[model samples]
Target: MFFTLSYRKTFIGSFDKIGDAIDKLKQHQESYSAISSPRFRKSRSGEIIRIDYGSSDCYYLIEKGERDDRTIN
Candidate 1:
């Protein structure tokens, strides 16, 4: 059986740059493709950016003066 995931958020940046950045990440799925490891839920939600290290994770939070994000229009 094949399970699919729905992406509510859209990746707006350059595909090449995003791929390159994904390569630079240490613990993301892209970096672990070569390793045979159990796949499970990682991120449940993402706003602007997300990062993960060996044992640590981070998510972007909107603080004062910032409105979650900026509008391009």
Candidate 2:
């Protein structure tokens, strides 16, 4: 089986092992989180609220078949 790492629906990289994919995903998330900042929006009552973005859910690990485009026949 092959593993594909994706971020925000875009393909990042393909890996031969699941562990490698997971490690890459973790690294990406950490990097993104470190640079990401919270946004503030005003509600209907004119109260400002902070919206924090979590990088954990933005990354995905997908298992691909042997005949996938990234794999050799």
Candidate 3:
């Protein structure tokens, strides 16, 4: 089996092992957290509507067949 990492529904990269994919996801989360600016949506009244933060929950690990074209090998 091969593991692939996806962020926001976009495939980032394919990995030979699930551990490797997970490590990469952690790296992404750490980097995202380093951003100084906070992400959020504001309302017309100038009130804070939503706040966004870096999280690993958004990253997905998908299992792919070894023969799958997206597999790294």
Candidate 4:
């Protein structure tokens, strides 16, 4: 699965699976300015799972890409 992970609108990486994606996000967990909870979303492109720290500061750790790799879609 081709994923577009980002932090502060900065491109992180393109993982192949949900597990890898989640792992990547966890690596940057402590970097968050605040702490609240996590969230998930399914869009027309792919799944977007993120964590909410506070304010508008959030990391879009998962964004399905259009690459024809090993993806759920």
Pick out the ten consecutive residues of candidate 2 with the lowest summed lDDT.
42-51
lDDT of 4 by residue, 1-73 (tens): 3344343354556777778866766665546534545453333533655544344445454566555434332
Model 3, position 25: C-alpha lDDT score: 54
> By TM-score, highest first, what's the ranking?
4, 2, 3, 1
lDDT of 3 by residue, 1-73 (tens): 3333333344445677756755665566466556444342212223211122334333334444443555332
Model 4 residue 10 CA deviation (Å) reads: 0.7
Q: What is the lDDT of residue 29 in candidate 1?
A: 46
How well does candidate 4 score on lDDT at residue 53? Answer: 37
lDDT of each: 0.30, 0.43, 0.43, 0.51
Model 2 TM-score? 0.43
Count the clashes in each prediction: 0, 0, 0, 1
Between prediction 2 and prediction 4, which has the larger lDDT?
Answer: 4
Pairs that collide, model 2 = none
Better of 1 and 4 by lDDT: 4
Model 1, range 23-69, lDDT digits (tens) per residue?
A: 43433444434434523323423333433222333221111122222
Ten contiguous residues with the weakest lDDT in model 1: 1-10
Q: What is the TM-score of each candidate against the true structure?
A: 0.24, 0.43, 0.40, 0.47
**Model 2: lDDT of residue 48:** 18
The collision pairs in model 1 are: none
